[model samples]
Target: MTRMPRRSVALAAAVAVLATACSAGGGAPKPKQIATGYTATPQQTGAPKDGGTITVALTPGLSPNYIYPYPPAAANGTVIGRGQMWRSLYRPSGEGDQVADAELSLAEPPAFSPDRKTVTIKMKDYKWSTGTPVTADDVVFSLALLKAALKESPANWSFYTPGQFPDGVSAEATAPDTLTLKLETAYNPSYLLSMLTLLYVMPSAEWNIAETGGEHLDFKDPKNAKAIYNYLTEQSAEQSTFATNPLWQVVNGPYKLKSFDPTTGSFSLVPNENYSGPGDSRLDQVDFKAFTSAAAVLNQFKAGTLTVGTLDSSYVTQIDELKAKGYSVYGAPAPARFDALTINFANTVDNFDKVIAQPYVRQALQRLIDQNGYIASRGIYNGAGSPNYSTAGSGSPYPPAFGDTPPYPYDPAAAEKLLTGNGWKVVPNGVTTCENPGTGAGQCGAGIEKGQKISFTLASANTPAYVGARDVAFSSAAKKLGIEVKIVTKALNYMYANYGNTFAPATKNEWAMQDFGPLYLAAGYPSSNTVFNADGSFNLGSYRNAEVDKLINESTFGADEKTLSAEVTRLAEDLPVLFFPTPHTLVVVKDTLSGPQSSFNALLSYLYSPEQWYFHS
Candidate 1:
């Protein structure tokens, strides 16, 4: 949730993200479906205004608590302010085909060596707000600090995989404007670039010192970098100082922090007049207002107090009223985003990890998820969600034929058959038990006791009504097969910061399943590298398979495109997490707001380019 654009922990609940598609309304008014793929390019007759102010709704509960570019998972919020304030080394692209927009990047596309083990990058002529030219030293400092952050804990930076990227690559500024990285292992250009998108540059000369106004030390030294990181993170923890902190004012992006309301987690930004990036800010001020729930957003929208923000689909029936109020609501499936009931493999509660380890048991769980039913039923996603089999999501080219056809469709009978066939005593409306336990056919998987009960907890985020509804549906289905699913409610930010067992060991046995909402990885290349890798920083489930690991490595380090397909396809069947329908992102903008259609890259999710936005008649 820090400076990186890699695996962002996005949720519709507004934790590290804005309000997205969710909620279910009772007794549908007109049975009008929430439209998808309806993004309209902003058009206005009059010339764009010179100066205007707009208030956007930050995802409720996901206000910036930590401002440091890299935050440990416990403190990571959404990328709402970070992207527009402190620029990443490479800007995320709106187009799905490209990993980053070359024009907006601080450096030109990197050139890999003949062996693909080394990379050379040339910097763009850009300056920070302080009038200092951005250079490769800044990028090198960022990477050095990133390595130090990862050193403290892999969870500090969720993108880090043990012995990969920052750990394996040695970087240096060969010249004032050039940086080079020598790699221990060759990498696919696309995969490598995907990792770099998270590399946010800072002012090396200004930030090299560990203390305020101290002598600048060489950040290449691990000791110096770690000390500097510690100091910056400590400063970031003081949320009241966000607007006044001089360390945060030395910006390179389009906006600079103007004010902060610590009580509400709302903040205001002014155009960084010296920003050297692609877009020009026609709006003088951008205010991100935080809310407690989607209903609050709907209230503001109704009161005409909001300019632009996402609206949950539970209010889909009210889109017409908003249209009458001169607002434009667009719904489209977010690119490279996926939602799942992220399982905790390390959660040994009720021998859950051991039972889930069985392929048949995993398949049985998958069969219980009625993705199509959830979307079709008026109470769940209604028509706002799309069926997706792979983490690649809606339009991914990867994955086998299963992309169009689910490998495991919902079937309560099949779920029961699998459990019964696996030597489980299935009792409808009662706890099912393992009648037989052994590493043989017709026996429950190893580690499961002879009389193990099939019951586990499912933690559901208490925001966005659709999430709870889906979990309830799944739980109801599980009950028919005598599998007990205890539903517990938790806040989205609580899940984002404290739920992952890999980083937050204290909470491992607290829950068996979690659905905080969709997590968006890098836009173009959505490879599940650290997400599913055995030792991945974000491997919350702790699910492991040597075969899937080998396939992921081939796709991440190998050059073949089909290798990525093989990786996603294998993951689709393996079910590292229980898949859910990918919901459409619904954004509501005031009619007066005018920008190119591309500016409304709502489907891309999380990265907001307000610099390109303007008000027009």
Candidate 2:
């Protein structure tokens, strides 16, 4: 995965002992601490052995809703689960978080035609568990299905425009094993390949439904499109009994679903004996269990019941105790996401627009945030977190590197100076009122009225301990700077529903700023088209910069690393969001199990090389 400079480590062995002492009434003895850095090399027992069952943990309450993996609402768990049964044309290379490299799975490296407007893919010698040979016709059919589904559910596919095929892209099966894609416009090979990675090849025989009157339905027909899309979508949602679902039984990956419980969001998988992949599944079965909170997950770890799980930064101090119990902790800088404070440019609450409209104010706010302190308090893996300076996170390959110096350092004095210089009167823990309110010199930019106070509510998800704490810390800091910040906590779903992209000025859910997330997985890529562009769907803040939009468009089609880096550098210089420290993903696995633990991509499901995972017996 992408590597960042390590932060200075502080030993907190005493804290671990104290925590254990406070909970000594437990039946099991307190776990002992072991001396080590953030990551310890997983212990190897011998040759890999099969037949043992491994239980994995999932995020609480989040279930796999759409088992047939097309995106608008395919939960992370669904990606991980469906991956076992569905195979894509090309699987992302598991080397790290980079999406540039791809491993040929269902199809070999595509042969591109001159001018790069056309490519041909040849099928690999793979077969479905149902004894049917995987063919190119299946690929063409899947692409058609995706195009049709985009009509009814546009958000399902973000990379392409809805209701229309991708610019100049058309697919057809030339032979049983050969499929060709012709593009009208020239596109970068890497970008095109990345696009292909998103399209999962489905079994056409099972998914393509016949319309009423025994006629084959044309998905492109406006009359038949919605019905066809709904039929396929509804079939995938029937997950009350996974084992009994015939649609799920066919497999191309290493595992197949054995059973699933809709209530607890728990499921089990067994090896796909007919899987034709690089390696075979070593474990006989794998189980996934969901928990509501980190504390609950920790309890499972303490009982030595979890085969594989994650530990957040709050649990970093408890690593030694976990190590003493024969668990191996592996830490990797989070490859695909970054935590950030998003300010809504379109915020309509209490004249919030009047104050935050000024770029100087946004820059000032960024400078006032104690990013490093926040990371130190919330991070679990020592030396793993780094300040994210731009939407293109620190881990991204593209960058005008921000280096060690932040554009806006955490200096409250400097922040106060900027605000006061821009015609705002500093009241110190009181409301900051604008004295001048025009675009002229010494004024608070445009749209500000005299005496307009800098006061707004910051919203965030209430769970995950860190989310609430981060917001509180930010709110407290702002308060000291003569800004009134009302902290409102809400469930994640409610927050997203009201504050997400669907947010509008007239809605009851008006938020001045939102403190949620590492940005979505797609934003992790070097391009800013999806997050920073003027019309970006995920631009929840509605921030629009003509220059940034131009740069994003250029990067989207293709750009050299130098050009891409310059664009990112300028973005950091322009404070679009209050970039926080990038969080590290800590993977804790039983000493007896081993496989690839580092994930450089957005989907955690892609992190596991199931064929290679095995019990070290």
Best by TM-score: 1
Find the number of clashing residue pairs for candidate 2.
5
Per-residue lDDT tens digits for candidate 1, residues 1-617, read 11122111122232211112224345554323455324554554456888999999877656666778887655664443878888888887766566887877899999998899889999999899998899999999999999888888877777888888887899888999999999999988888998888889888878887888888888989999999998888888888888898998988888999998878778899999898777779999999998888889999999999998888766776788998898987776676778888889888888888988888887898899988878765566756778877878767656455657778888889989999899999999988999988978899988988989888998888767677778877887788888998888887766766778777789988889998877766667778888888877778878899999998899889977678878888888888889899877778888888776667763247558888878887
Positional deviation of residue 154's Cα in model 1 after best superposition, in angstroms: 2.5
In candidate 1, what residue range of length 10 has the lowest lDDT sum? 1-10
Candidate closest to the true structure, highest lDDT: 1
- lDDT by residue (550-613, candidate 2, tens digit) is 7765655553435566667777888667877776666777887775433212222224555667
lDDT values for all models: 0.79, 0.65
- Model 2, global lDDT: 0.65
RMSD of each: 4.2, 5.9
Model 1: lDDT equals 0.79
Q: Name model 2 segments beyond 4 Å from true.
A: 1-36, 40-45, 71-80, 93-97, 158-167, 210-226, 378-384, 502-509, 520-525, 559-561, 596-606
For model 1 the TM-score comes to: 0.93
Report how far off residue 151 is in candidate 2 (Å): 1.3
